[model samples]
Target: MEKGQRMKIVTRTRAGTITGLMVVVLVLAGLALPAVAPRSLIQDLFFILTMLSLAQVWNLLAGYGGLVSVGQQAFVGIGAYAMFAMVILFGWDPVPAVLVGGVAAVILAVPTAFFAFRLQGAYFAIGTWVIAEVTRLLVAQWKALGGGTGTSLPREATSDIMGVELIRTLFDVREAAARDILAYWLALILTVCIIGGIYWLLKNRLGLALAAVRDNTEAARSVGIDTTRLKWAVFLIAAFATGLIGALIYVQTARISPDAAFSLTDWTAYVIFIVVIGGIGTLEGPIIGVIVFFVLQSALSDYGAWYLLTLGLLAIAVMLFAPKGLWGLIAARTGLRLFPVQRRLVGHDINGGK
Candidate 1:
């Protein structure tokens, strides 16, 4: 074998091992979170997982699919409200209701996609925001589902049997802690699975086609790729993921309101901040962005607006100095990948074995 070929083989092997270990470690950490974390810590971790999922879904749509949407809060609100309505009006279990919320969001996404797809570029952004506003108004006027005042999950709604002291006693301390931990692990696992699912998609033929369309939609269509269908498919998938995360958010918080549910700032600003800071296009970027976001949020929890201002300044710096983002910068320099999406030959086999 040629020297170059041998070196290439070694490099690929090393990269594969590194990638495998990174995933394994992360998975183990997530699984073990509940057992180790206290009740208070578990809540915060749940919030972080929620943000991570949001950042990831947004990254998938904007970074890879080239559909820069600014109104994912539409799905978030839909999911939250769906969960609320189910628990309040229909007497459904919150666990199942959460999944139902996601399904409902996807249902809404279909018509919304039809309208949003009619617009292109910045117009689509505006269309999404407008659609969200309209939906919020409609929900607000509909008094059946809390109306303008919004709705809350009944305290007793989640129990298997209403006001069962035995159940409460069983779940009061460690049992409740265990349940919270389980929820955290569930979110974490789903987040990792979703990321892996997206990675697999991008590594496949459809992903290549999406990339082609993103590179040049006209050219992709000329080559027989259905750009419209592709966009809608991605839009729906993104909606599903966003909706699921939204449900997760409410599940942890145990409450919902239109102001909180439909707030674009939570989904848009935070996801954008996470994606931009982490590196928009790469698989690991959102993860890094979430870490940075939480770090700042934790360190500056007391400083309030100043912390936000600092984030803004940092984003500006990333945009100016590292347009590709933090993950992009690190990937460019160190060639390290926690979840590598691409593989390339760095060398070839030599005439004789190394």
Candidate 2:
């Protein structure tokens, strides 16, 4: 103990520095993947990146904001539908229409939060799902978009998208394959932005307020934290991101349907599984979870019902044994944190006591 010593707050660790370097290298590789990788591989990566983005948003809602919404597919569906409307009705390009999807999701979130925020626990989850179902029913009635059966992006829309031509010429691939590459690149960029943004938020004051609210609402309120506002921010942000992801997904597929776009199993249930299996509260959880899920899906997809059963069993086993998730267990044992967000105070002396 020295009188001249002072304490400074820090959030970085050796592991985090190393992880950041590794992430940069990985992202660079991902950016160049279309040059050498097979089209199938690129498609698979698009799936992984989009799913990871969805899982992270869900984690932010349920894990950080204490808002467990099971109707997230509503945003995904609405976003996709909005993109479709832009392309089919107004002759807009699909690329820019994706932004409209995000805006649409935020629009949906306002009324959704107004209603669902009043409920608690399981009721909130159910209320969200109910709202999604209603949205789906309404979307199914839009005859211009093929009514209940859904519709495809016009041939011109898909063939003449913004960046597909550049990719086709540069990579010397067909229009379809070039579109895949473009979508894959966009997915990579979106994922990097979402993950980096969330990490940044977690290292800032808003993250502290979010954590306080999540841990104890009354306590955070006593300290003058506006809990409702925080929750709304988290909800709306998640909605916007999810919507963008949804629109991108449909752009890649060049098709949209009410049932498929709003599927609970695809958008919400699977995302919840990813977060729960990977570790809900940590940034690394979704990364680890999505990898595991993709592997399982690849191996067991042929088994149909058994595949789902195995996933359910595995999730239950993890809940019972790991509780905090696979990454949580690994972190507990190895103290590895690729994305460290917790603050620590360290002492240093004025006399250069390094």
Model number with the top lDDT: 2
Tens digit of lDDT per residue, candidate 1, span 1-354? 543344441223466577778788978986665454568887888888888888989998999888888889899989878877888889887767878788988998999998988898899989988988887787788687778777666767644422233433544554345446556766887788788788788877778788888788889999999887888888999898888788767766666777788887787888899999999988789888999999999999999898889998999999999999988888789977666556455543333334
**Residue 96's lDDT in candidate 1:** 75
What local lDDT does model 2 show for residue 165?
Answer: 86
What TM-score does structure 2 among the candidates reach? 0.97
lDDT (Cα atoms) of all candidates against the true structure:
0.79, 0.93
Q: Could you tell me every candidate's TM-score relative to the true structure? A: 0.88, 0.97
Expressed as tens digits, the lDDT of each residue in 1-354 for candidate 2 is: 567566778889999999999999999999988999999999999999999999999999998988999999999999999999999999999999999999999999999999999999999999999999999999999999998999999998899999888999898999999999999999999999999988998899779999888778899999999888888989999999999999999999988889999999999989988998999899999999999999999999999988888888889999999988999999999998899998877777533576
Flag regions of model 1 displaced more than 4 Å.
Answer: 1-13, 161-179, 343-354
Root-mean-square deviation of each candidate, in angstroms?
3.8, 2.0
Q: For this target, which candidate reaches the highest TM-score against the unseen true structure?
A: 2
- Tell me the deviation in Å of residue 336 in model 1: 2.1
